[model samples]
Target: MSGILRFLLSGLAVLLTSYLLNGVHVRDYWYALLVAAVLSLANVIVRPVLIFFTIPITFITLGLFLLVINALIILLVDFLVPGFNVDGFWWALAFSLILAIFNSLFDDITGEKAKRNQD
Candidate 1:
């Protein structure tokens, strides 16, 4: 799918996931789109540095420590975005895991799987 399409779909995923989890309150879908755009940028920029810095912990935990990183990212988003509230550290952890799983499935269905498989 095109980048615009992917972006829009990802925004939808965020909206849905936000509704499912108690993490964020979106005023409307436009707010969700804004949240998703910030999230995508953060993932592209912030996540790499985090992964690099935490490689030791990741290795020690056999990669399970990624959950903590994900939680931190989620918490970061909550802090950065007004009206998007994360209840607690544990809530961030749970919310990110669910978001990750759901977004993976969303991407897979939206031609991401084909693109990756082709690559």
Candidate 2:
């Protein structure tokens, strides 16, 4: 139940982020949901591998490289999902940052983070 709520919130975040960013385009609410699911899967499956491989660079950049990895994940989602488009790497980066902010805000509002910490 919580997982489903989280998924819906994530989709909302995607839609809102794309609406705010001129360079990011989401075809509709359904596409936003699809993007959210694909993005979550990429973060779960691909992010760790990317972090492991880029440890040296991540360290050298004082963790800033994680942002690049996040942008790359956005690009990967753009490629895999139809009706979702990011203008370029810069746009993808902006989209990622904004989406993260929205997700964080949603989590806080829903007390999801508090529940997670208790668990």
Candidate 3:
């Protein structure tokens, strides 16, 4: 299904991000998959709530606060998942940015955009 494909793509993105960033560590592809799943779930459940509560600050910062929220989610996943580690706050922030970039690129390369048109 498309969802499964998206999940795998996200895992690949995580692996790619870890490879490019010095302070981010993913033990293996399995851990990358797990990290991707957790991040997806957190984005669905936790991120919206955090964003809702931080709307004022998010607006005040001209949307920059979302980056901090993304870093916090990365740190949360680091705590909840084993074998995936982000070195520090700065590294986590960097990791989030890189992961986002990689995920977008992977989605585009894998025909996900074309699939979206059909849906």
Order by lDDT, highest first = 2, 3, 1
Error of 3 at 81 (Å): 0.2
Which lDDT value does model 2 have at 116?
90
- Judged by lDDT against the true structure, how good is candidate 2? 0.97
Ranking by TM-score: 2, 3, 1
Question: 1-119, model 1: which lDDT tens digit per residue?
Answer: 37888778877877787788765566678877877888888889999999999999999999998888878887888888885777888888877777778779887888787887898
Each prediction's TM-score versus the true structure = 0.87, 0.98, 0.93
The candidate 2 region of ten consecutive residues with least summed lDDT is: 1-10
Q: Give residue 70's error in model 2 in angstroms.
A: 0.1
lDDT of 2 at 12: 96
- Please write out the lDDT profile of model 3 over residues 1-119, one tens digit for every residue: 87898899899889999999999999999999999999989999999999999999999999999999999999999999998999999999999998988887877888888888898
Give the distance in Å from residue 24's predicted Cα in candidate 3 to where it truly belongs. 0.6
Candidate 3, superposed: residue stretches over 4 Å from native: 117-119
Q: How good is model 1 by TM-score?
A: 0.87
What shift in Å separates residue 75 of candidate 2 from its native position after superposition? 0.3
